[model samples]
Target: MERKKRHPQGSGPTFDQLSAFIAQLEAKGQNLDNPWLMTKILSKFTEDIQRQVLEEKVPSDDTRWNLRQQMHCLDMVLTQEEKIELQLPKRSEIKTLESSKKEYGKTKDIRNVKFCFYSDEKDHWSTHCPVFKDPKKNSQHLKNTNRCVGCGFRSHTLAECKSKGCQRCGKKHHTSTCFEAEASDFDRTKVKSDDARKKTASAGHNVVDGDEEDDPEAQESSTENSEENHTVLTAKHSATKRENQEGSNIFLLSGTLRTKHPHSDEFVQLTVLLDTGADRSFIEATLVHDLELPQQGSVLMKLCTFGNQKTTVKCMKTRLSIWDICGKQHDLNPYAYKDLTQGNVQGVLDIKDLMYINEKKIRLSSSAHGYIEPHQPRVIIGCDQLWQFIKFDEPQFTLPSGLLLIPTIIGYMVSGRKFQNGDIPELLDIHDTSLA
Candidate 1:
């Protein structure tokens, strides 16, 4: 047998293979003590194991002693290796791998097929529809075609459609066609009406008194009413907007990293959000359970959220091994959370969708943008451990639209906010949290 045919050091030919080879040589009437026969059998043993056998003290008279003792030594080494492998940390679990396969199968089904809401066609998805490129034209087409503004279907109208409404207005209309300014104005008007009703109820006697004109309180009330009327009109009809715009978009940094399986050579892919503002790193508890990770004891953590709300919870820590863009491995121990944010970092992206990135020849960690799954990240690499995973030597790319592409150990992360088709929803208020 060729030398290359021998298995590697950690996993060599099985004991059965060695036994069969020896039996074959014995049947040929070859001398079991022949040095050539012994050498051939030894070749099948891994290089490391062979070396160990050579160090054995065999009486010079017993040449076949090493060959006969090989099986017992090999078995001992294999068992020890198995124990060590079990002690090592693994990235992916068998259950996760199986579920991923099922998810992939589901993604291939007819329901997951791409379709354009604008043209009601399968040639493209709604995000890439030609009609959707222009808000006015898309809305006009939906109206002209008698399609539901909420879900782009002809079977129902906007009011009757059961699909989720615009995230901006919470109205029965698509986000692409939502007018946030209108919603804000309406809300302000309702609040003003409620205030006026309350004032009328509390000061009913003052309004009926003609003698109140001489009273300073009555005069002040009249002046306030006039100013309020002027303010309402200015808000409704003024072309100029307020100092802080009602709607603003915010994008958090996120990317995908490769993780190695502890027992096997296979690597697992994980999507993670890089939060420099966060004090502690976190991983989803469900994922930790699924991966069957080893916990290094528990910590009593004090979690603080928006409005200074604080809660005490028990947190478990587990080791993680992730590969960077250059295939450098990083080991980390992050606390576990029952859940993370529901928001996703970016929408489905493809190379064709981002021609600018291609024009600039920007290198990315992920090989294919189309294959980057659009799912909420389960891992958050907080500031406490963020520097260890960042590549300070690499250059950062800033797009014309204010979107920033940052180079980190894991990948080139796409971050910073961008207005989607001039549709800016309400500004998101992110509260910094403290973890102990």
Candidate 2:
């Protein structure tokens, strides 16, 4: 006789228990990503709890809190931002609080509640601000402070000081920062001292000085070279910063994605961003609120984000069926990364399970993407898998070096736009650094 397979059994927590559990997790800075755990917690929510969450408990009886709506309410409560703006107390609430304080002969200073930049009102929206018009009166007045470093006054910001020609030798610059000017003054002083010494020696006896005075021309050339080198260094530093900024910017492929659990008969469709370089696939927590998949084994892994920032990512793995928009399912064992994203791109497809098709789209398993939508794919395909779908075709060129340099990084030098008529799709190498 065949034996029945054992399954992970769990009952949903009560509404009160679930709420408290969520609060504890949030306090510890934990993120919920396990679809099974999420299902268990929300399943036990009573109609009263759901109504309370949806504000349906209010005196208005017309409020209908559907399953999706209730799930969204729970999701909003679970998520938080690094910098949460505090909601100011309403005028009525402030008045009530002040009245209560007055009963005890106390007063409350609530001046800090005002946050509008365009208004002087204690409480106001930007649209109601009176100073928004005629901004000259409301401006920060930064131009008035643009005093000249040379003059120490507002007449001219870039021009030299007319009052004190040059502080160093009445020539053209400030004494502190003028190295060349200071050197010239030192040379002049040395020449004057030598002339005085020679005149004094001639008065006493006949004396001839054989040594020649130090050359100012050589020193001046050296100073000019130093200045030129400093300028070159500054230009190089600016260039390096520009290159680093360009290299660090993100370029992710986006498209619509459809996914479902292994045991689930129904597929859930969502928009996903593919990380063309992530080791494992991931799904957003919010998208799995309705999914009832059993919890798989938990794993702890080190994840490195942009700029090589290392962090620990707690994940739960389960076999997921990735379906094409046409309903074709692709077998993929993907992990649900706890609170990885905060948007509609619910799942990140792995590059290992994907292949680029034609010249315009990417294929997940065998289903390819075409056209565009509001929520496109943001899936980051991994490098190892990306290599398989990428191949370069070297165009014919007669050169002297006898070397074929496949232009990967700088494809812009060859082409202006992509997919023009008569353009062969196979020759288009998007996986190269040009697009990658």
Candidate 3:
């Protein structure tokens, strides 16, 4: 007896059966509108036929078989329209990759493949293989054999490795250039230890010994000696120290000459000081007459104070020869006053009136001989005029060393009269209440 074949339930058509049927149709080159094949296939698969009708249009025998084969391989059951929706390549069609390679090798047309040239015009050229261009496309490729995978140079690839040049020095070697290498490894701990030792040594040396009253006589003598030493040290180190006092008083002496009124030819120079404390600079009447300086006719000026007391006096413009300690000279136009009673001086110099005045830091001290009386030659230099030439250190109140001392000729207003009596009435009144 012959064995009977069994059909699996719900089992769709197998891919091999569909593929074979499609292959035969393709070989015969059937057209898409064949109704005979469509009816035969649809009747065999009723459910699939309905699904195909709803989803897609009917296809030729070749397309239908091709889609059925793919669907069966994917474990899918398709309707008649789905089978018809499948499209198959013509028998005369060529493979894309193979055609691309052939066109690239024959014409070197970059559009035929994925490669592009790195030129200004951005010309695209194809490669025989995706990995390598054909030798016929460019002579450079033939000469170099192949391109470098690492750097894209035709001479060598990474697999046929060659020496890589140093990027820093442009040398055909690794980064071993003398100028590019690290100088030395830094040892922060060693640096810190050295600094600590120096600080400790300085602190130890600065420690003072003994109390202030340990030796009364000895201390007195030491104090005197220290004072002398200080003077000597200051004088010695003064040359190296820069003048930084912004408001230091500056004094200049003008050469003297014979006056017509005095009738005696006594060479005298006007002494002028830049007084930042006072609003203006002043000169003694004696010096002004002796110097025979140019004088502009007098004008009335009012002098006042915070107390609102005012005094009117005549001011005259005068040109005086001024000389600095640095040996520089200037012709200063300063105001002179008619009333000497207002101030002990002949004129008060106001720095703001000066045309081109240069200021400098000067050091003044009381003379040990006491030849000059106190308040006799007292001069006040204001801060506004002085600030332009120097900078000050508050703690020292002295100028730093090495700053240039420039000579400037400035025009200034000299107060015609002194401040009114009530300007500072407190100075005039002395109270006996303290004694009582």
For all predicted structures, in order, the TM-scores are 0.39, 0.25, 0.23
Clashes of 3: 43
Looking at candidate 1, the ten consecutive residues that score lowest on lDDT are 229-238
TM-score of 1: 0.39
Candidates arranged by TM-score, highest first: 1, 2, 3
Report the C-alpha lDDT of model 2 over 169-198, residue by residue, as the tens digit: 564433322344435567888988888767
Tens-digit lDDT string for candidate 1 (346-391): 4434344367677767665544442334456778887668887777
Model 3: weakest 10-residue lDDT segment is 231-240
**Candidate 2: where are CA atoms >4 Å away?**
1-251, 260-267, 306-309, 325-328, 339-371, 374-436
On lDDT, who's better, 2 or 3?
2
Model 1: lDDT of residue 426: 42
Q: Give model 3's TM-score versus the native structure.
A: 0.23
Best-fitting candidate, measured by lDDT? Answer: 1
- List the global CA lDDT of all models: 0.60, 0.37, 0.33
